[model samples]
Target chain A: MTRFALTVEFDGRPFMGWQRQSHGPSVQQALEDAVHAVTGERTAVHAAGRTDAGVHGLAMRAHVDIAKAIAPFRLMEAINARVRPAPVAVLDCVEVAPDWHARFSCIRRSYEYRIVNRRAPLTHEAGLAWQVPQPLDEAGMADAAARLVGRHDFTTFRSAHCQADSPVRTLDLLSVERVRDRLFIRAAARSFLHHQVRSMVGCLALVGMGRWSPDDVEVALHARDRAQLGLNAPSDGLFFVRADYPDEG
Target chain B: MTRFALTVEFDGRPFMGWQRQSHGPSVQQALEDAVHAVTGERTAVHAAGRTDAGVHGLAMRAHVDIAKAIAPFRLMEAINARVRPAPVAVLDCVEVAPDWHARFSCIRRSYEYRIVNRRAPLTHEAGLAWQVPQPLDEAGMADAAARLVGRHDFTTFRSAHCQADSPVRTLDLLSVERVRDRLFIRAAARSFLHHQVRSMVGCLALVGMGRWSPDDVEVALHARDRAQLGLNAPSDGLFFVRADYPDEG
Candidate 1:
């Protein structure tokens, strides 16, 4: 079997998540089914980030093993052609080493969370961004975000159903930037404890609203308890931006 | 009566255009009906650009006169609240002079056309951008576009069904810029003939595709005939970006 690496982009509105579920459709099932239709092989496609429902992906990295002797471009074309009219598209595809796994081999993962700071209700950006009606102090949010940048036991951020064995992880970067009336939160790390990004963003929003001081964020991280979580931001604002691997730039 | 100016944004996928249509919904009709519901007055909303079907608006300037004793912010909030569930948002509103007509008093108009140069089918940006699978020579297109600037009788670019009395118009700016795999064509002028921007962009695309030479563009422009037009691009990628008036920057 030959392992093929693929870069995929998708709009996550109609998806149940990256993982297949009995209740609804998923990105993995969509691609796997497309692959089966094209090459007659029932294979599982693994992604670097298993995004939740209502979350988008710009360039989610993944890998699949196929026994068919197909060219990389031909496989990508077949998958893209069969995946529609689903909102999944294979952006790039290439052959990779057999040991290179999609999830386990990923070195860094990045996500971007968008917030539209405005009074008017969302029009074009309804499901694409989180809308905050009240004014947000972006500088304060940035200050609060700085406290969660380094290594820590992020127990307060992990979801209850997270299957990760360890709560300790090093966060490489967490930045809050104000672009006009929009606030963008960019997070990067080797790995995260499930809802870590959303949980941290939610607390920073509290700082933006003056509800929680910057000191409160550090205190919550030190507490390391899920009960201290202020809020879990909705999945609509989050996007799995990209995943970095060792062989790739 | 108070003349209020509004900065509107909308996703034009669901409407027949900005003007009121007897067969389908329009942005103007939605806002007018919302105004009637709020103020109990039959009003007409005039916009700077009356776009074609399936075209979007980022910050289209518009005006409406209402005889109600209401503040600008309250009127804006009421209209936004009532126009709910529609892909239209009143981004900003302020009182203007009675003579400040939306269309007649406009000094400059700007439009942007987006082209996604990619082989894969669109997923996240289906209706938002026009996807061309072929490679585009953006620099060549820019060189061809520079030939269209300044005063000219743009008869070859106008649509056959255009209602303009005169085809002579001054194009202040036309620039083609390539950002990664996306091509953005921005155009600004005091005004434009019907289907002028789309027609120019379609020919520019031909130049980018190597089908037409840069000199061919100049020859077509000098032809001064509609039959010489190569193509009229789809309205899906066109956006009425902004409208400038004398009183406001």
Candidate 2:
């Protein structure tokens, strides 16, 4: 058996999410079916992160083992071809160590949230970005984001369905920048709890809109209660950019 | 009577173009209907440029004259509200002089073409950009673009159905730049023949792909024959960025 690592990019608009579900289609089911069609074997695929519905992926890392010996180029091309008419694409594929784990071997993960601060309704960016009709103060949002960095109990920012054992996680970076009418919030960490990034961004957005003070972020983090959350931003604006592995160069 | 100059933005994937069509929907029709709904008066609206189908607008300039007495803010808000569910928006509205015109008063027009130079198929940017799988040489494309940035008889770069009265046009600027895996071609001029921007970008793409030399662009321009055209790019990647009027700050 040969193990291959795949970098994937998907629209995330049509499926239930990355994980396969009994009720609906998903990115995982799409890839597993395509692998079955090409290799005549049903194989399980694991990803570094299981994104939510309506969340986009610029490059999510995954791995699968196949019994049939095939060239990496041919395997990648065949899988991409078989997944036609779907918004998912396998960007890069390569042979990896048999023991390498896509879920466990990951070191870092990063995400970005996109917001269009404009009064006009979205057209091209309707589903791709969050449209906040009110103006947002980027400086104020940045100040508020500074309070969320470093190790802390992020219970207020995690989803009730999250399966992590503890709420304590290290946030390496969280920065906000404004370009004209657009606001981008970038967050990086060793790992994140489910819905953590979106939940933090939601409260920061209220601060940017002047509805909440910067101190409120610190207070909410101390409360560690889900009810203290200002809001949970929609899934449309979140994107999983990439995953980093150690042992390069 | 009041004449209001409005700035518009739209995603052009759904309509047949900007002008009213007999058999299909158009941006003009959308705006006209929205106006009639709000003011109960049918009015003709004129735009600075009538973009073709699948061509997006960032801030298209237009004007409409209404006999009803209405505030500029109310008029803009009502029209935007009534145009719901459509991918159109009114960015700004102001009362212009009685003789002000959207088309005749325009002094300069600028456009941008986006090309994603990558091997993977687009997902989030499916309709917003053009995907070119081959590697593109940015410097080569830039060198070729410089050749077409002056006064010339651009017969080879025009559409056969274009209704321009003269083939002679003075192009003020044309520059190509590569930002990572993307290429942006910007063009500005007092006016342009139909298909002019797309035709030039098509040839530049060939130069970047090494199929044609840089000097071939100059030769094609000198030939002044439409038969010498290398290609006419699709309407998916083109965008009408802005129009310059002398009276604006």
TM-score leader = 1
lDDT against the true structure, per candidate, is 0.93, 0.92
For model 1, residues B45-119, the per-residue Cα lDDT tens digits are: 999989988999999999999998999899989999999888899999999989989999999999999999998
Off by over 4 Å in 2: none
Q: What are the models' TM-scores?
A: 0.98, 0.97
**Candidate 1, after superposition: displacement of residue B9 in Å?**
0.2
Looking at candidate 2 chain B, the ten consecutive residues that score lowest on lDDT are B119-128
lDDT: which candidate is best? Answer: 1
Collision pairs in model 1:
none
State each model's C-alpha RMSD to the native: 1.1, 1.3
Tens digit per residue, CA lDDT, model 2, B116-211: 998777877887788998899989999999999999999999999989999999999899988988899999999999999999999999998899
